[model samples]
Target chain A: MNITDLDTPTLAADLDVLERNIDGMAQHCQQLGIPLRVHTKTHKVPEIAKLQIDAGSQGITCQKLGEAEVMVDADVDDILIPYNIVGKPKLKRLTALVQRARITVALDSEETAIGISQQAIADGCVVPVIVELDTGSGRCGVQSPQAAQRLAQQIMKMQGIDFQGIMTYPSNVRAKPFIEETLNLLSSDGIPVNIISGGGTGSEAASKEIGCTETRSGSYVYEGMTRVGNSEMLTPERCVLRVIVTVVSTPTPERIIIDGGMKTFTSYPPTPYGHIIEHPDAKIYGMSVEHGHVDVSECSHRFKVGEQLSVIPLHQGMTSNLHDKLVGIRGDQVETTWQIAGRGKVF
Target chain B: MNITDLDTPTLAADLDVLERNIDGMAQHCQQLGIPLRVHTKTHKVPEIAKLQIDAGSQGITCQKLGEAEVMVDADVDDILIPYNIVGKPKLKRLTALVQRARITVALDSEETAIGISQQAIADGCVVPVIVELDTGSGRCGVQSPQAAQRLAQQIMKMQGIDFQGIMTYPSNVRAKPFIEETLNLLSSDGIPVNIISGGGTGSEAASKEIGCTETRSGSYVYEGMTRVGNSEMLTPERCVLRVIVTVVSTPTPERIIIDGGMKTFTSYPPTPYGHIIEHPDAKIYGMSVEHGHVDVSECSHRFKVGEQLSVIPLHQGMTSNLHDKLVGIRGDQVETTWQIAGRGKVF
Candidate 1:
């Protein structure tokens, strides 16, 4: 099937562009001598994760254990879950996943480490875990170097647990000194740090400078509009993922409605959920549950009903979670269809 | 199964509250002498749609043909789709849906009417369509009464098409005059306007005053935080849908991270994505893909790791679409698990 034959408000991935993005980031990380650990949270498709692994990624990183389970089912053996697995139910699932694959989790607190240790001991397996440092994102992770050392020390002392260094997201330039100091403190304490994984697509190029032995970049495979606007390496042309939407109504000269809306795209931040690839001037000012309201007063081009428009999502990861499958395209033809196996596996 | 046994960051529906909410709205519409057609977009489960139908809804309303298809498979014969179906592919699907169920579509433009008419003509079936009026929602529909009349005239003149009056969303107080004027204009033109359907959960009580024959309210079945905040009939206690999230980290005195975030909750509008049932002062200020960053400085309750929090989403429809199933709870026990059959069928 061709691009025009598919129904409206569906996600399409440009295979040519996707391959280029994958190879480009992989080669860049290889050249920098920083092992790339592609994050599966962005695409959530096992095929894409396998492609990333084959393209020279050291391992895959999943934000949730449910996602890690999906990757394991897809034959991906090495996975890192960079989030705390709380509660017995989740840790039980995490233990099963660890039994199937070489899984490592990131914990920021002693309580979480103890919980994982208890589950791992019951399962008769040693689960490797990394300390998540706050660095700068201010989301999750240990705030200070002392806290990191304390957490690492707790993990090392716990039975059925292996402390495997530290990791941070967005490995910003500001995190360098803190990571170095933490490494020095650990070294002084006679603790071996195997993995110092730090990276986001935004900071992948500077991962080495940020003292990261391995980098984890997810959005690099399917460059979103935000990345396109922020990253010097990414352009709109390089964005592999696009939501193909059709103009359903032009209620007024200024207002136009598309088939895709908040349900189709992520409603998160930076006004206008997506960028219209065909009309740069038209701004998607608002969105309802099923309607994307675009203001086309500035655009000279007139939009007729039934006309299809490709939109690059502002955040590709969140947008991909809303879709069931990704239509892989190569030169206006659908090359393959990959199911988003981990789409709603938020647990 | 029980609520506590389920994994974290999952959607749960309080069955008692759900039944009460469904019956309350149905009885309210019955008392108002307005036919209640529950929109299935809120909780896209066919089982819940069936429950709404059994609770006295005249029919079910779907936003897309794909959703209608799911409803049809579940044996819902009467369905109304309140959106313009453009393009041949979607039209083909709509025609197939029309064969199995009594389907009505909404249109505001001649281009869309012609496309539906041509498809209906090819199928040798007369498809009923309603002219959608703007009425101040500013999302979809004709801007003025004249535009609504023109679209009605075009649909009336078309072959294999039945003009089924008009409909508008959020049946605002200001839309009363426009709806009455459009109905008068159509009646004066000797066109029989059978159904003047107008309603959303926000405007369901006022639907009769707004001159609506039938009211369509989706979120009433599982009222969201927005509806609970706006509607006098709804309270937070009546909201059936709650996202069960676990507190994964307490990074600082003020900041706490939950297992749910933008992936689990709707990021649209009104700040804080959800309301914590136990702690009203704790605000979910920001969210990443899988982590909800909450500020709990004001709350006196201490949150330990693995503590479960039930959050009522600001927008339940968007949040429901992110999950595969809704854990139906009846007094802390999971009585049933209903698959969200129409979850990602956005096409």
Candidate 2:
């Protein structure tokens, strides 16, 4: 089926743009001599993760255990989850995942480390553990080098756990001194830091300079408005994903309503939830659960009922998570349909 | 199974509160002498729709054909879709639905009316059509009473299509004059208005006073923070839905990270994305794809790793759409797990 043949309010990825985005990031990482670990959280499709692995990505990174399980089913062998896995139910699932693939988890607290260690012992497996440092993204991680050292020591003492390395998200140039200090402290303790994972699409180019061995960037695969606005490397032309919506009503001359809304797109802050590809002048100012209210007063073009429009989401990661499948398109033709295996795998 | 047995970042509905909510709305509509037509968009589970119908709802209202299809499988005979149905594929599905059940569609444009009429003719069926009036929501509908009369006239002229009545969402007291004017115009034109649906939980109490025969309230079944903040009928205690998330990390005394985030809950505007049921003072200020950054500095309770906290979302409709299934709980025990049959049917 072609674009018109598919139902409205569906997500479609341009294959040509997707390949270019994949190749562009791969080449950049290759030039920097840093192993690229593509985060599968953005696309959530196993086929896209496999494609990334084929295009020179070292492995895949998932934020949740349920997502890693999906990747394992797709024959992905190496998976690094850069989030603290707590609770017996989740740890048991993590241990099962460790049996099928090389699983590495990041933790900042001793309580989390102890839980993983217990689960690993029960499963008779040694799980590699990474100490997450709060080099800057103040979301989750140890505050200082001394804290990282302490966590690393705790992991080393555990029976079925090994201290792998250190990792941080949204790694920037400002984090260089902190990362260096942490590595020095680990080195002084004679701790073998095999992996120093860092980077998000926002700070990917500076990851290697900040001493990150591998860059884990998810949005680079399906560049959204946020990435395109921040990075010189990305453009709207390279945006692979688009929410194809139909103009269901134009109630007034200024106000237009589309079939897609917050349920179909991301509800992330910053007005204009998405950018209209064909009608750039038309602003998507408001949204309800199922209707996107667009202000098209300045636009010279007129929209009619049943007319379709392509929109690039402000946040691609959350938008992709809202859908079950991604319709892959090449030029004007339909290429393939890939199931978003980890769509609601928030656990 | 219990709440602890399930993984973190899952949605759970309190069965007792759910039953209370259903009975409360049913009683309110009954007292007002208005037929209640509960919208299924809030909780897309067929079981919940069945419960609403059993609780005295005349029929069900859905925004999309995909959702209506799921309700049809659950043996719902009357379905009113309050959105303009466009495109050949969607019309084909709507026509098939018309064959099985009584299907009514809301339209403001003649093009949409003609489309549905032609599809109904092809399928040898008559589809009831309602002219949506722009009373106050200003989202989708005709502006003036004359426009509504014109659309009704067009519908009356079309073959295999019957002009049923009028409807508006989030109807308020200010819309009373508009509804009266539209009704007067239709009466003057010799049009029989069978149904006058005006709704949303925010204005359900005022619907009858505003001259509405029926009220379509969705979020009333599972009240969220928005509803609780708006009406006295809803309270945090009355809210049936809660996102049970685990405290993954407490990086600092002030900052606590949960397993739920933008992917699990919503990142919509207005300070906190959700309200913590256990810790009312804790503020959910920020979120990444998989991490909910909450500030618990003011709270006296200390959260430990693996501790589950129930969160009342800002909007129940969007939060319900994010989950694949709703874990129905009574006290601490999971009573049932209902599949959200229309979860990702955004088409």
Query: Judged by lDDT against the true structure, how good is candidate 2?
Result: 0.88
DockQ score of each predicted structure, in the order shown: 0.73, 0.79
Lowest summed lDDT across 10 adjacent residues in model 1 chain A is found at A227-236
Candidate 2 local Cα displacement, residue B223, angstroms = 1.3
Name the TM-score of chain A in model 1: 0.94
- Candidates in order have lDDT scores of 0.88, 0.88
What local lDDT score does residue B171 receive in model 2, on the 0 to 100 scale?
A: 76
Across B1-347, the per-residue lDDT of candidate 1 in tens digits comes to 76877788989998989999888988888888888999999899999999899999999999988899999999998999999999989998888888888999999899999999999999988889998888878888999998888888888889988998899888877888998888888888989998888878867767888888899998878877667674332345778888999999999999999999888896666667787887878988998889999999998988888888998887889899999989999877989989999999999
lDDT of 1 at A7: 91
User: Candidate 2 residues A48-121, lDDT tens each?
Assistant: 99999999999999988999999999899999999999998889999888988999999999999999999999
Candidate number of the best DockQ: 2
Which candidate number maximizes TM-score?
Answer: 2
Worst 10 residues of 2 chain B by lDDT: B227-236
Residue B10, candidate 2: alpha-carbon lDDT: 86
